[model samples]
Target chain A: MRITELFNDGQFVVTAEVGPPKGIDCSHVVKEAKEYLSGIHAVNVTDNQSSVMRMGSLPVCVAMKNAGLTPILQLTCRDRNRIALQSELLGAAMLGIDNILCLTGDHTRMGDHPGAKPVFDLDSVSLLHTVSQLEKGVDLAGNELVGEAPKFAKGAVVSPCSDSVDAQLAKMERKVMAGAEYFQTQAVFDSEKFISFMEKAKQFGKPVQLGVIIPKSAGMCKFMNNNVAGVHVPQHMIDALAADKERAKAGITSVEIAAQIIKECRPYCQGLHIMALGWEDKVPELIKLAGL
Target chain B: MLITELKSKEILDSLTQGKVFIINCHGCKEVSFPEKEAEEFEKALGDKVTGILTTDYVCNIDNLPLRLEKHAAAIEAADTVLVLSCGVGVQTVAEHLPGKRVCAACDTYALPGHQGVTPLEHECDQCGQCYLNITGGTCPITACSKSLVNGQCGGAKNGMCEVDPTMECGWERIMRKLKQVDRLDVLKCPIQLRQYNK
Candidate 1:
C-alpha cells in the first residue's frame, strides 16, 4: 500500500529504513527488504547515509519495488545539485518509485570523504517544492513536460526534540508549504518531550511517524549521546543500559526502552518509524514488545 | 560578531619569525574575547614583541586607520602584524595595512541569535536564500545538522542528529511550527534554487 493510503486509512503506520551497501551488491538489500516487508508499511532506502558512499537509494528502492515491497526513496541535497536531483526524480518516477523523502544529507565532514565538495544547491524544502511542481506537470524552471508528470506521496522529516521549538516549527511549515503530505520525525526517546511535541504537531493536520531507535548497548547509547547532534539519550535510559552486566542483556533493555517510547508516544502520532540501525531482525521483536 | 578561539602556538610560530606587533579587538564585549589569551601571547613572545595595540571594534574599518596611525612607528618596526581578533578584524587590518604581513591568531565560530546583539539560542548562516519567511522564521540552513532544506535525514535517531546527540534535530522543530501557523501550504511552493554566491 502507498504510505499516503496507510496514513489516510487511519491505521497506525509502520515504517523502517534500510541502507544500500557501500558497493553495488544488491543481495543484502534484497534480503533485508524481504525480512522487513511483512512487518512494515514501507521501507526507506537511504542515500549515502552518514555521508558514507553507498549504492544509490533509487536503485535499491527499485529493487524493493520489484520485490513487491513499498520503498521510500531517500534523496539528499548533500550530493546532488538541483539539475541532478530533478533529473533523478524523473528517473525514479519512470521506474514507478513514487514515495520520496527529501533531505539535506549528512555533511561531507561526517562521511568517509570529508574532502568531497558538498552540493546543497537545493535543500529538502526546495526539493519538496520541486516535487510539487513536477506533480503539476512542470519542471523547476516552469518548463512543460512532454509526457505525464509522476504523482508522488511526498514526505519530509521532523525532530520533535528540538532545542528551539519555534525554529523547528518554522522549517516544518515550509515543508508543508512545499507540498509534503506526510512527515517522519527523528527518533524520539524522551516521552515527555515527544508528547509535548505531538500536542503541537497535531495542529498541522498531517500524519507524523515518530522515529524509534533501539540501542544495542550502553556504549552505543553513550556514543549517540556524545556524538549525535540533536539526539538526547535520557540519563535514565543510559543508566538502565549501563546497569546490565551482560551485553546480551543490555540489548534486551534497549528494546524495552524503544518499546516504552512507542507505547507512550503512540497515542499522539499516526504511526511509528522504527530505525533499527542495522538491527533489522529485532524490529519484529520491538513491535511485539511495544504491543504495536 | 563572531566568537573566536586562539590558534595553536605552533601555527602562530609558523606565521611569525621576527619582531611581532599584536592587535586585539575589544568590540565584541557581548561575547568572550581573548583577554587572558592575549596576555599569555604577550608574555610568550617576550622580547620579540614590538608593541601591543588593543582597539575597540577592529571590524570597523573606518576607525582602524586612525587607531593604527597612533602606533605607526611601532607597526613599522615589526616585521609581522598579528591580529588576535575574529576573521573580519583580521581581514580589515590586512586590507588597510598593505605591504605588511598580516596574520590572524584565532578562528571564528558561529553563535545563535542575530543582529549586532548578544547571540541567543538561534543563529543565522545568511545563506543568501532565506527560508525564514516560509519556515516560520527558523533557518533550515543554520539549524539542521546538515542544513537540509527539504526534510530530516535518516541519521536522526530519537530526534537527535547522528553526528551530535546532545542537540535536538532541526527539521523536527520546523514541522511543529509549520503546523502551528497553519501555513504548511507554503511548503508546496517551489523554492527557487538558492544563490550561494550571495
Candidate 2:
C-alpha cells in the first residue's frame, strides 16, 4: 500500500527507516529492505542524513519503490540550498516519489570536524514551507516554476520528549499550516509523556508516526541514558537489565529489554517506525510481538 | 556535558567516509565511566563516528602484549582509537596498534575507588598539613561545604548550610557529633599529613 493511502484509513501503520551505507554495500541495504518490505507499509531512506554523508536517499528510495514497496524520501536542508531542495521535490514528483519527510538535519560542525562551518540557509520550518511551495506550483524565491509541481503527503519529525508541549505542538501546528500532512515523532519510551503530548498534537489534526528504536543490549539502555538526549529510557529498565546480565544462564537474550518497551508503549502510539538499525530482520518478530 | 565537538551536519557528512574508529577500555571502573562519557561525546561528534567498543577487561599489566595480538579483528575495524585506560594502557594499546589516532579518553588523575569523579574544576588545593581533626575529619579546603576557613560562614544557618539546605554545616555537624560522643577535646588536634604526594 502507498503510505499516503495507508494513512488515509489510519488504523495502525508499520513504517521503518533504513540507513544507507556510504560504501557500496548495497548488499546489506537490499537484504534489510527485503526484510522490511514484508510487514511495513513504507520504508524511508534517510538522506546524507544527520549531515554525515551517505549514498543519497533518493536512489535507494527509488530502489525500494522498484522492489514493490512504498518509500518515504527523507530530504534534509543541511547540505542543499533552496534551489536544490525545490528541484529535488519536483524531480521526486517526476520519479513518482510521493512521500517526502523534510528535516533540517544536524549541523556540519557537530560531525567529525569541529572546525567545519554550518549552512543553516533553510531551517526545517522553512524547508517545510519550500515543500509547500513546490506543491503550490512555485519556487522558494516566490517565482512560479514552469509546468506542474510535485505533490507529496509531507511529514515532519516531532521529538515529543525534547521541548515543552507548547513548543512542539506549536511547530506541529506551523508545519501543518505549511502543508505537512503527517508527523513522525522521535522515539517514544514513556507513553504517558507522549499521551500528554498528543493532547496538544491533536490540534494539528495530522497523523503521528512514533519512532520506535529497540535498544541492542543492556549497555545500550545506559548508553542511551548517558548519550542519546530527548529520549529517556528509564533508569529502572537499565538497572534491571544490568542485574539480568548475570542471568545469561537463563534463556534471556539481552535484546529482550527492548522488546519490553514495545509491549509497554504499543497502546499509546498510532504506529511505530521501528529502527532496528543493523538488526532489520528482527522487524517481523517485533511486529508479531506488537500483534500488528 | 563535556563536548569534544559541536553539532554540524556538513562536517558530519564529510567524515562518514572516514575509516571506522574504536577505543579499547578493558572493563576498569574509571575506564567504564569515562568510556560512557566518551561514547556520548562521540555521538555529539557530528560525523566521523565509525564504531566504538570498550574492551572486555584487564586483570594484569602483562596481559597487553599477547592479548592485544588477539584483538586484530577489532583493531582492524577502525582507523582511530581514544584509549580510555590509563597512560600505561594507552601506551600499551598504541605500542601495538601503530599509526592509528590513539588519544586518552580518561584523564591522567588516576585514583582509586568511589570518591574520584574527576571534577572539571579541581575541588581541593592541599596547602600542606591538613587540619581535618580540628574540623571534625572534614578538611576546610575540601569538605567545609563552602571551604570556610575560620568557621562556618553566615551562609551556615541553624545547623544546616544555606548553600545546600539539605547539608549540615561541615563544621557544625562535625562539632555536634564530637560533643555528642565526648570527643570535643579531640577537636584541638591538628590534622596529620594529607598532601596528595602523587
Candidate 3:
C-alpha cells in the first residue's frame, strides 16, 4: 500500500527512513529495511541525505517495493528545480510510489562530493505547490494534463526543536497552506517540549509524525546533543544510559525507556519515525514492546 | 546525521560546540546487505555500537596518519569499530589496527552509485573476476536482473527491468550501458558463474 493509504486508513502507523547505497548494492539497504518487517508500517528511502553522494531514491523505493515493502520516496528540493521535480513526480506516480517527503536538500558543500553542483531552484514549499498541481490534473506549467493526475498523499517535515520554534512553525504553516497533508519531524529528543509544541500544533488539522532515534550508545547521545540539529536528548536519559558501564547491560532498559516515551507521546502524535540509524534490527522489538 | 538532537538545550545546561566526523568513501565505497544485516548484530550488542563512519579514501595507507589523528582516541577507547567503508577497507582497518575489535558496517556491494531506485543492492563482490567479458557487466547478486544466471530469459522489457523497477536488471542495464559506451559486443561467450565463486 502507498504511505498515504496507511495515514488515512489506520489510527496510527509506524514508519522509518532507509538511506540508499553509494553503489549498485541492494543487500545492505534491503537488509536495513528489514527492520520494518515485523511491525513498522512503512519505510522512507532517503534521497542522498546530508548531501552525500549515494544512489537515487526512486529506484531504491522500487527495490523495496519489489521486496513487497511500502516505501515513501524522500524528494529534496536541493537537487531539482520545477521542471525536473515535476517530471520526477510524474514518473514516481506512474511507477506506483505511494508516499513522498519533500525538503530543501543539504548544501552541496556539506557532502563528501564537495565539487558537485546542487539544483535548489524551488524550495520545499514551492515543490509542494507544484505537487499539489499534479494532484489536480494540471501540469506545473498551467497546461492541462491529458492523463488523470495522481492522488499523492503529500507529507512535509519540521524540526520542532528548531532554535526558533516560532519560525519553524511559521514555515510549517506555509507548507500546510500549500496543501501538505501531513508532517514529520526531525529527530526529537525532549518529549516534554514536543508535547508543549503539539499543544500549539493541534489546531493545524493534520496528523503529526514524531521522529524517534535510538542512540547507539550513551556517547552517541552525547554526540547528538553536541552536534545533531533540532534534537535534544534529555540529560536524565543520557545519565541513565551512561550509568551503565557496559552498553549491553543497559540495552533493554534504554529501549524500554524509548518504548515508554513512545507510549507517553502516542496520544499526542499520529505515529513515530524510528531512526535507529545503524540499529534497524531492534525497531521491530521496540515497536512490538510498545504495542504500537 | 547532524548532531542536531544533542543541541536542543533546556534551561539549566546550555549546549556548546559540537562536531561529527565523516569518512569520505572516495569512489570506492558502497553499502550492501551485510551492513543492513549488521544492524541486528549491533542491536544485539546494544549501546556498544557507535556510529559506523565509512570512508573511501581516508582509511587507506596514504591517509592513515590523518585518520589516526582524527579517531585515535575513539579507537583506543572503544572495544569495536563499526566501519562503513567497503569490505577491503574494513579488512584493511582490521589488519592495521590489531588488538581492536573492528567489523564491517556496509555490505560492500559494488562501485557504481548513480543509477536505479534500489541502487544499493549487491552488484559486484570484487573477486578479481571479470565476467562482463562474457555475460555483460551486470551483477546477478545485486541486480537479480532477470534471475537468468547464464543469459537473458527474454523477460526483460524496454531498458527498464521487469522484476524490479528500481534496478537496471544487470543484464538489461549492461546491454544498454555497454551499447551506450560502445561496447555492445563484449559478450563474446556465455558467462560461467562458478569460476567467480566469491
Candidate 4:
C-alpha cells in the first residue's frame, strides 16, 4: 500500500531503516527486515549512505518489495548526475516503488572512497522539483516521456535541532515548495526541541516522522555528539548508556533509550522513523516498549 | 587571492622530466604564495631548469602576451613551460604558448574572498544570481558545503560544520548576521528554491 494512503487515512506510521550490503548477496538483509520490520509502514533503503559504496538502494528496495514489504528508496545526488538520477527515478517507478526520499547526500570526502568525484548536478530541492516535473510527464530538458508518467509520494529530510533553527525552517519551507509530501528528520534526542520544531513545521500541513537513533553505547553517543552534526545526546542519557561497562546488556539498554525518545516525541509528530544502525533486531522490542 | 599549494613532489617530478621553463606568477599584492617551496623545487630541478620568469597577474589576458614575449627565448629553449600559478594562469599561459607543452606546478584552492578584487571574509561563487540581498550578505552557495540556498542542513553542531569540523557552520553565520541586522523576517518569507541552471 502507498504511504500516502496510510497518511491520508490518519494512520500513525512507523518506519525503519536498513542499509544495503557492500556486495551483491542481499538475502541476509532481506531476511532481517522481514523478521524484524514486518507490519511497519515502510522500510528505508539507504543509497550509498555516508558516501560508502554499497549495493544500490533501488535493487534492495526491489528485493524488499518482492519479500512482501513496502520500501522507501533513498535517492542521493552524490554519485549520479542529473541524467542518471532521472533514469533511476523512472526505473523505480516502473518497478512499483512509489516512495522516494530526496537528499543532498553526504560529501564524497566523508566516505570510504574519498578520491571519487561527487556529482551534485541536482540537490534535494531540485531533485524534488524534478520529481514533480516527471510526474507532469516532462523531463528536466523538457523532453516528453514515451508513455505514462510515474507518480510518487515524495519525502524529504530536515534537521530540526540544527544550531540554526531558523535556517532549517527556511530550508524546510523550500522543500515543501519543491513538492516534498512528507519529512523525516535527522536523529532527534531532545523532545523539547522537537516539539518546538513541530510547532513551526505543522504549518506546512505535511506528515512529519521524527527520527529516533538507538544509542548503542556511551562511546557511540559521544562520537555522534562530537562528530555528527545536528545530533546531541544529553549528558544523562550518555551516563545511562555508560552505566553498563560490560555492555552485555547493551541491546536492552539501547532499546530502552530509543523507546523513551519515541514515547517522548510521539505526541508531537505524525510518525516515528527508527534508525537502528545495524541493530535492526532490537526494533521490534523498541516499538513494543514505546507502546506503539 | 587564490591560494595555491605545490603539487605532490612525485607528480611534479614526473611532469618536469624534460627541459622546463618556469613562469611563476608571484600573485596579487597581499596574497600569500609558496615562493620558498617553488624555489626549492626549482633548485632541486637544477640543470633541468632552463630559465625562470617571475611576473604578476598572468590571468590578465592582455598583459599575458607581453610577458610571454619577454620569456619567448626561455620558453623556446625548453620542451615544456611549467606554470607555478593558479589554474587560470596555467590556462592563460597555455593559450598564449600553444606550441610548448604547458603544465601547472601548483594546485589552487578557493580562499574565502579570492573571487573578488579585495580579499574579505566572504566568497561569491558568481552563480549569476546574487542571493546576498535576501540572505543578509551571506552567500550560502559559497559558504555552505552543500551549497544549500534554502538554509542549514542537519549536520552543524555548536556552530561548526559536520563536513569540516574546523569550519564555522554557514547557516549559523548567516543566522547570526540576520539577527544582528534585524532582518530575521526575511527568513520567514515564502520558500525560494535556487535555480541551479543560473
RMSD (Cα, Å) for all candidates, in order, is 14.6, 23.7, 23.4, 14.9
Model 2 lDDT on a 0 to 1 scale: 0.59
Highest TM-score model number: 4
What is the C-alpha lDDT profile of model 4 across B1-198, one tens digit per residue?
456678788768867878999989886763456999999999999988889989887677768788778877878889778888755566556546644556677755555563524233445454534454355555677777777766676667788876788888877876776676465676655444555553
The lDDT, on a scale of 0 to 1, for candidate 4 is: 0.81
Predictions' DockQ, in order = 0.17, 0.01, 0.01, 0.32
**Comparing 1 and 4 on lDDT, the stronger one:** 4
lDDT of 3 at A37: 54
lDDT by residue (B142-184, candidate 2, tens digit) is 5444343333322333445544556665656445444443545
What tens-digit string does per-residue lDDT give for candidate 1 at A1-292?
4589878889898999999997878888788779755667899989999889989999999988888889999998899987899899999999999899988767787889988987787888788888899889999889998799889899988878866555466567767878889999887889899898878777788899999888777778788776665567898888888887585463688888899999988888899988888888888888899897
Candidates ranked by TM-score: 4, 1, 3, 2
Candidate 4, TM-score of its B chain: 0.57
Cα error of candidate 3 at position A281, Å: 0.5
Off by over 4 Å in 1: A247-250, B1-192, B196-198
Against the true structure, what is each candidate's TM-score?
Answer: 0.67, 0.56, 0.58, 0.74
Candidate 4 chain A, run of 10 with poorest lDDT: A245-254
Give the candidate number with the greatest DockQ.
Answer: 4
Question: Candidate 3: what lDDT?
Answer: 0.61
| DockQ head-to-head 1 vs 2, winner | 1
State the C-alpha lDDT per candidate.
Answer: 0.76, 0.59, 0.61, 0.81
Native contacts present in each candidate (fraction): 0.37, 0.00, 0.00, 0.62
Q: Is the docking of candidate 1 incorrect, acceptable, medium or high quality?
A: incorrect
lDDT of 4 by residue, A162-273 (tens): 7777778877887888899998999999889999999999999999999999898889999998788788889988898888866525587778888888888888888989
Alpha-carbon runs more than 4 Å astray in model 3: A35-38, A248-250, B1-198
